[model samples]
Target: MSGDGEEDASLEFTPTWIIAIVCTVIIFMSFFFERFLHYIGKVLKRKKNFALFEALLKVQEELMLLGFISLMLSVSQVSLQKTCIKESLMLRGLPCKRESPNSVSHVTFVRHYQTNFPLDFTGMRMLLASESGGSGHCKSMRDWKSWEAKIQQEDDTAEKMVKHVHELQFIKKRFKENKIFSWLHSFGKQFYGTITIDDYRAMRLGFIMMHYKDNPKFNFYKYMIRALETDFKKVVGISWYFWALVIVFLLLNINGWHAYFWISIVPFILLFIVGSKLEHIISNLATKVVDQNAIAIGNCVVIPSDDLFWFKSPKLVLFFIHYILFQNAFDIAYFFWILTTYSFGSCIMGKKAYIIPRLVFSGIIQVVCGYSTLPLYAIVSHMGSRYKKAILPHHMHETFDQWLANAKTNKLKREETSNEGTVDKFWGAWNRKKASNKTEVVAKLEEEMQEVQHEPVPEIEIGIHN
Candidate 1:
C-alpha cells in the first residue's frame, strides 16, 4: 500500500508539471490584476501622476530587470510564449475623390464652395451614405433636384440657388489660391528677401527665451543682483584700504611702503583679465544682438557715451568702439567685482573708510565703463534711424520712384552711347580671358553660375485644370 501511494503521488506531481502550473497561475494573476485596475478607473489617475512618479518608475524598471535576471539564474527550466498582434495605422497619399450617384452629384454641383455657404451639406451627405445604406438619402436628393427644376419654371428659388452655388465655387477658388501650401512653395527660394536684420534680432531673443523659459535653476535677475552686490562690496573695501596705507606710512614714519604697492599689482592683473572676458561675452552675445535689431528696424546709428569706456575718444572712433565694447565692459566689471570680493577678499580686508586704492580703481572702472555705454547707444540710434528711413512706407515709395527714374536715365544714356559705338561691354574681358581656356571648362563655369542665379517659379493652376 505504501509503494502504491508513492507511485500515485509521483504520477500526480512531476517537477515539470508543477513548474507549468505555477507559471500559468502567475501569468493569469498578472492579467487579472491589470484588468482589475483598469476597470476601477485607477489607470487614468496613475497616468496623471507620471511627473511625480517618473523617478520611482525608472528605478522600478531597473529593479524588475535585475529580479528577472536573478530568477532566470536560479531556475534551471525556461519557458517561451508566443502571441499574434494586429493594429491599424493611418498613412497619407494623394487625395482621391469618391464616386457619387447622379442625384447626389446634382445636389453637390448646385452647392458651390466658393461664395455662398451651405451648412454641413457635404459632411452630412457623406456620413449618411457611408453609415446607413445610401438608398433613402440618395433618392431624396435626386427628387429634390427634379423638384427644384420644376420650381424654377414658376419661381426665382432655382435662380437664387444657382447664384449661391456659383458664389460658393468662387470662394473655394480664392481659398485654394491663397492656401498655406502655395505660400511655402512660392517663397522657398526667397529667404534673404523676406528675412531682414530685424528678424535676426528677434531670433536672438527667441533663442534666449527658449533656453531659459522653464529652467528654475537659472534666474537672470538673481545673477545680476549677485553681480551688483559683488561690485558694491569691492568699492567700499578698496576705499578703506587706501586710507589705512596712508595711516601706516605716517605712524611708522615709513618713507616708502613698497610692499603695499607691489601687492596691489596681483589684484589688478587678475581683475583686468576676468573683467575683460566677462565684458566681451555680454556685449557680443547679448547687448550687441539686441542693438543690432533695433538699428536694423529704425535705420539709425546709436552712440555710446563716455561713461561706458575708460578712455575718451574722438567722435568717429568712439561711435564704432562704443557699440563694440560698452555693454561688454559693464557686464564684465560686475563679475570682476564679485570675484575679487569672494576669492581675494581684498576689498573688506582693511579698516572702515581706510581708502583702499584697489577699491577706488574698481569703482573708476565701473563708472568709466558705464558712462561709455551712453555714446554707443547714441550711435546705434543714428544707424537705426537711417534704416527706418530706407524702409518706411513713404520713403520706400520715393526710393522706388527714384529708382525708376534712374533706370530710365541709364537706358537713355545707354541708347546714346550705343549710337556712338560704345557698348560698355562688361563680359568682353571675361569672354576674351576664357577664349584660350578649354570650351568644356568655360561652358561648365557658365552653367554653374547660371544654376546659382536661377530661381525656380512654382506652377499654379486653378480648379481641375492642373
Candidate 2:
C-alpha cells in the first residue's frame, strides 16, 4: 500500500520544467493576444479618434502586464508550498501523498497552518488535505468536525482583521471630509470641471514634449504622426499573417500537441522581428513626410504651448513620478488582495475553474477605477500647479502676464465690435423699411441712429481670469 501511494504521489506531482514552460507560454499568449486585438481594431478602422483609442490601448496593455505579474507570483507561491510540503513529509519519514499544482488552495493552507501552528503535527495533517484528498485527509471521519471548527475559527479571525482595516480607512475618509480638506477638494473639483480629462492628458503630454524641445531628434508632432501612421500601415499589412500564426498555435494548444506549440511559436517570433523592421522603415518615411509639411500638419492640431514653464520644473517632474509610483504600488497591492481573497473563498467552495475569468474581470475593474479617479486625485492634490508662480523664472512669468493681458484686451475689443454690429443691423433694417414710404420723421431718426453707431464705445476694463 505504501508503494502504491508513493507511485501515485510521483505521478501526481507536476514537473518544474512543465510549470516553467506553461508560464512562458501563457505570457507569450497574452502578448500576442493584445497585439491581435490592436490589429483587429486597426483593420476595423476603430482608431478614427486616435487619442482616445490609444489611451484605451494603453490601459489594456497595463492590465495584461498586471495579470502576468500576478500569475508569476501565484506560481511562485504554489511552488514554495510544494517544496515545503515535500520537505516536511520527508523529514518525518512519512509516505508522500499525491501532490498537484492544479489549484491555489495551498496558498490558504500554507498561510494558516505554517504561520499559526508551525510545530503542530496535526497542522501538517490538515495541510495535506490540500493535496488531492477531497477534504478528508485525517485518518477517521470524526476528525472532520474538528477540521470544520478550526477553519471557522480562522475565518472569524480573518474577518476581524479585515474589519479593523476598514475602520482605519473610515477614519482616513473622515479626515478628508474635514472643513479645510473639503474646501480644497471643492476648489480642485471646480478646476477640473473647467478642463476635461482628455484636455488634461493632452496638456501633460505637451508639457513633456516642450521639456524635451531642445533635443534635435525629438519633434513631438513628427513622433506622434510617425507612430500613428506606422501602426495603421503595419496592422493592415501584417494582421492576416499574425492571426494565422496565432490560430496555428491555438490549434496545437487545443489538440494537446504540446511539443508542436513551441514549434508553432517560432513562426510568430520570426514574424514579430520582421514586422518590427517593417515598422521602423515605415516610421522613417512618415517622419520625412511630417518634416516636409510641418507647418500644414502643425496647423491641423492644437499643440499645448502655454504653461510650459510649469511642467519643465524638475520638482514637478519628480512629484509626478512619485505619485505614479505610489498609485501603481497601491494598485498592485489591491490586485493581489483581491486574488488572495478570491482564492481563499474558492478553496472553501471547491470551485477553481473561475479563477481566470475572475482575474480578467478584476483587472478591468481596477483599470477603470484607477483612470476614473486619477483626474480627481491630480486636482485634489494640486499636483503641478500649486508652485507654478514660485518656481517660474521672472522673465517667463512676465511674458505670461503680458500675453494674458493682451488676450483679455483683444477679447473685450471683439465683444464690443460684435455689440456695435448688432445695433447697426437693427437700425439699418428699420431705416430700410421706412425708406419705401419716404417718411421725414423716420429719415431724421435714421440719421441720429447712424451718428450714435459711429461714436466710440467706452472700454470697460476686463478683470484677470483663469
Top-lDDT structure, candidate number: 2
lDDT of 1: 0.34
Local distance difference test, each candidate: 0.34, 0.37
Misplaced by over 4 Å in model 1 are: 1-207, 213-257, 282-466
Report the poorest 10 consecutive residues by lDDT, candidate 2: 128-137
Give the per-residue lDDT of model 2 (tens digit) for 1-466. Answer: 2455545445356577877998999899978977886785685455354433443454455455445645675567547556654534432311112244344365554664333211212221222111111222122222323433443344322322222211332122222324455445433432222223233233333334444445423322323333333222222121234336434432332212232323423323332232222222222222333334333311111133213223434243223322222222322333344345455442321233433443443343333223322222222222222322422333456699999999999999999999999999999998887786678777889999999999999999989998
Report the Cα lDDT for candidate 2.
Answer: 0.37
Superposed Cα deviation of residue 442, candidate 2 (Å):
99
For model 2, give the RMSD to the true fold: 32.6
- The deviation in Å at residue 279 for candidate 1 is 2.7
TM-score for model 1? 0.16
Residue-pair clashes per candidate: 67, 0
Candidate 2 off by > 4 Å: 1-40, 43-47, 51-64, 82-109, 112-311, 314-466
